[model samples]
Target: MSNTQKINSTITHASINKCAIPYIRYKLVKKPPEKYIKSLQLDLFSQFVTNDKSEVSNTVEIWESIPKYFLTPAQVKKLRTDTGHADPYEWNYSEKGGNFTVRIQPALIKQGNNKYQAFFPGITEELVEEALKKILTIQNHGIHDVNKVETWVRFSLRMVLKELASRGRDRNINQIKHAIEVMSSCVITLSKEKKEIWKGSILQDLVTVGREEYLADTDAQHIGRLPLFISHAINQLEYRQFNYDRLMSCDEQLTRLIYKKLINRYRHANLINNYHFMYSDLKSTGLLQQNREIDNRKKVLSALNELKEKNIIANYETDERKESRAITDVKYIIYPSNEFISEQKAANKRNSDSDKHSIDPNLISVNKS
Candidate 1:
């Protein structure tokens, strides 16, 4: 069959039973509550519908259903001492929104008898995670074991390096390896109303094979496991999809973060309307870290200009509030580019197509064959 025909067939079959395991479970439930049944049906349908990575495209899937506070901002950086060695101290990042506070602590790793080091999740870690997600989507059909809390993913070190290269960044195997280690070691803790909802490392159970020379070779394969928290998050239906190529084309980390944040904010809004954000609010998200207001404004302007050059934003205007001739605050009004609007519309159509083809749960039956 042609690739298009094959994809259509897969989608049709998936829509019929929504995968065998979930359908079987649904049948086993006798008189399940309405809420429970709805959740189950949604979960079952989501397994096949939400992830459209199989369709030929340059876009990559990113999990956006999880609370944004759980993510460490681009501004977070690794600490270094005067001697140029990593600072062996623990630091905490906490953000309060409404009644909940999200906190992240980079767990200290023992280096020797008396030395310890802490690593924060930054751009490199983010790149590694994105590459992994892309690999999973391409090879595993973006399927994760719902029965297991942690899912094992096998990938070549060189594969990750190549993925990074495609995303407009080139790095050696050691750099990728170190980023994976940091992701595995860093601890993210979330609490709502003083009750801890979840806490875990971004990745865990990492294993690398091959001798030193072989491992250094570009073709060597390695494996890493996603933690329970991440695994559960992947099973959720809601997510954000973006053009991987466009995102990686960004030369600066700040610009990339700003683009992602704006895309998420603009998902449901009309493209004709202007969107605005306070400079202080952007700072709260960890995008701007300059100590002075003027410096921060410059950083924002530079990033916005880059976004405009990339055609992600059509244009942006900055409004400054002054008190006694001193700038008190700044607001940025962003105009979405046609390219970005088209991408959003395409994503919406894909989602709508998935929903349109969805079959009722009562009509689905297990295919024992």
Candidate 2:
């Protein structure tokens, strides 16, 4: 069948608002907002309902291929102590492999800034960021327009709390607010081979306006914005979709990170069932911070067990290398669950269907002929 026929068949099987098709086509090519808004009004005035819920529990890839350690999984108190008396909580980390070097410097705030004190984004901040990304994907805004620094979203603390709740994280309004502050305040400078790639906070220009009591309410709404770079990445389609439900199911920070790493690797490998990684290499991902080898080994084992219990992975085997009767290194062979593989396959098919259907609104008539 023709691409158009295939798309139409799929759309017919799944009831999609016909009026929204024009908007979707326009959005696929990154049309101007005013133009798309006009199209929406003219094309989808009556019987128009956005199917935003279809995006729930899916994430749009935002973070680049930087080391996972960019955002430490360490506890907040330990992170604070490790940074010492340095104002703005600055620290430098470097990793070298083969011919390239990655250098990262993360600070709570830009140098010489005394207004806001932020720390390295821990699990809480990471969760908050993921929630925001989910919101961005659902709303389908900000990402298409990279030139506008003012591209922002207005959402309620209640809305954020609800998203967090879906991930099995029960955080209060105060904690959510703090996570936003940290994300907005923290500045990260990442470079490869001495060439700066990224330099800014995860979020910027956050403006929240609501009374404490009102904001505390479940229905209260507020606003936050993403950085321009993030928007650009989303515009470039440099994102990944993951099952948020499974990610949040892993209770420990390392487990969640490991799950993410595995998913990325598996996807890259075309959904292969088996994959292996050196234990020391995994430790370097910043997911493992325990000082002693035994402690780190225990943490890794526990995380793997949690993944198994959650059915994210079918099973895993570890190989320990010993030098002079002392453990020198470890390796892991991971087997992904059948369910996880099926989920990924379904997601890929959905994306493929969407792509097949995405013809420019202007060209739809010609293509139909």
The RMSD of every model to the true structure, in order and in angstroms, is: 11.2, 11.1
- Tens digits of lDDT, candidate 2, 161-280: 888887678788878876776676656554434434345556655555555655457565444556443443333322345666678777887787777777656763334558887777
TM-score of each: 0.69, 0.69
> lDDT for every model?
0.54, 0.53
User: Candidate 1, residue 22: CA error in Å?
Assistant: 23
- Which parts of model 1 have CA positions greater than 4 angstroms off? 1-102, 107-116, 141-143, 147-152, 210-218, 227-233, 268-271, 357-369
Candidate 1 lDDT over 309-345, as tens digits, reads: 9998899898998899998788899999987887777
Worst 10 residues of 2 by lDDT: 1-10
lDDT of 1 at 140: 34
